[model samples]
Target: MGFDPYLAYYHSIDYGRASLASDLNPNEGVYLRREALKRYFVEYEGMLNREFIRQETEENTTFQKCFRLQTERLASCIQNTIPYIPFELGI
Candidate 1:
């Protein structure tokens, strides 16, 4: 919505989402950024899932909180990497 940091243009597509463009440096790596986000989110999900399996297991609240913050920042980095120009598809 606002200027995103790891900038990629987002829009609705029949595919469920649309990606229009990006401003990532060749070395900055959108691929790496995407992988990192996926890894962090998966880790968070695993932590919560483990809690369900073992009631009093590590109580991963602290790591989850920290990971949540990291994901937000990483998401921002991905969002702001380019200009998000949107246009209507059926115009």
Candidate 2:
């Protein structure tokens, strides 16, 4: 294996599901136990575990709702922001 500190960190945290985000060499596993372990562990362990699926789903839904609301608010703010205007002043 190569000597990449980030890869070590990724393995330590077991970013199996979102491996592409962390793993420097993300690839499909055709005949490796490591692939099997990643599939198993992600489905049965850590934040993405079945036990927390409901919670994770709810959080993502809420995040999307809140994000949409915030973007709408930002759009309103932008629309109401002052517009530039040129005016001549007497010297």
Candidate 3:
């Protein structure tokens, strides 16, 4: 959390650019109809709550939990100079 959003490892630093935020942005543009949007949200919510075995913790975890875990992991990596492992969604 003490990270400088503009400072990035793979991306070049530039004026008014948030490289970290840009790196986390969705790669695809989302465009959906009303019904499709509803369906998408339903699936998205389901995915957020979906449980899976986390390799690091060896316990079932949801997307929301993984996000929190990854955030903490990143913070630890930054503070302690440990390697940060990115989260992977198998689905």
Candidate 4:
């Protein structure tokens, strides 16, 4: 990764912090799991499996696949010195 983990776009700057991860995180919250890590992983899997319709193509895509596309877009934006367009899960 060419990015500095501490240099964030959305999160506030802090010493020795992984702000870039925060910026990319879709689920931004604290999950104090009573079911250990199992529930966390299960829920995350479910979220990734969830589907959404593409506005331009009118095709369905999983969030996991969308995440890959978004990552590629972000990398392209960085290399080309262009603005990063975030993924939108429309309501």
Candidate 5:
């Protein structure tokens, strides 16, 4: 089965229906997945920057540490989900 990220986000909320997003045509699904991944990486990069600032700041040491840990986990999850077909890929 293929996957369409936008359709999944937009249509999967309804009850008693299979995900139309997952049933997308292969080409469209791949394109949608690529775009979704790109957006995810952008957001992840922003989160990393925010986490870095939090680590550097002195306010809310405990909260900062927690956020850093959460950010790291999120980065790892995103990395794992991405297809590993390219060697020169950048975050």
Candidate 6:
């Protein structure tokens, strides 16, 4: 039998094999994923700047904070558009 990949992967497991007729709204899942990504970026930025710097100068600290903020903003933009971009998942 022919099966749609999106239905097979995203719909089948959650609603069960026979209940394909009933599917939850996709918006909630999308929102949850986006929130998770935001949390991940927050955590990642903290981890990246945890190492000691050779120069304990105010300028160095300011530069690191600015860099992390920019990186986080960029990550947020990317996550917002992730749904429009097609991606394949590996099992």
Ranking by TM-score: 4, 3, 5, 2, 1, 6
TM per prediction: 0.24, 0.24, 0.60, 0.63, 0.25, 0.23
Cα lDDT of model 2 by residue, 2-90, tens digit: 23243343545444444434465555543748888788767544432223212323433333344345556545555687442322121
Residue by residue across 1-91, what tens digits does model 1's lDDT show?
2333433445323343223322333233445488899998898678644522212343334444544555566556676874433321222
Compared with the true structure, the alpha-carbon lDDT of candidate 4 equals 0.81
- Residue by residue across 1-83, what tens digits does model 5's lDDT show? 22334445344545654455444442334434888999988877665455222333434334345555555654565568843
lDDT value, residue 85 of candidate 6: 24
Expressed as tens digits, the lDDT of each residue in 1-60 for candidate 4 is: 456788888999888879888887837567676787788889999999998797746799
Candidate 6, position 36, lDDT: 95
Q: Write the per-residue lDDT of candidate 6 for residues 33-87, one digit (tens) a residue.
A: 8889999889877866765432434233433564555546545656575433222
Q: Write out the backbone clash pairs for model 5.
A: none
lDDT of prediction 3: 0.83
TM-score leader: 4
Q: Give the per-residue lDDT digits (tens) of candidate 3, residues 1-91.
A: 5578997777788899888776776365568999999999999999999998987678888988888888899999988999999987655
lDDT of each: 0.46, 0.43, 0.83, 0.81, 0.48, 0.48
Instruction: Show where candidate 3 strays beyond 4 Å.
Output: 1-21, 26-28, 88-91
Off by over 4 Å in 2: 1-61, 82-91
Q: Ten consecutive residues with minimal summed lDDT in candidate 4? A: 24-33
Error of 2 at 81 (Å): 2.7
Task: Identify the runs in model 5 with alpha carbons over 4 angstroms from their true place.
Answer: 1-32, 51-91
What TM-score does candidate 6 reach? 0.23
Q: State the lDDT at 87 in candidate 1.
A: 21
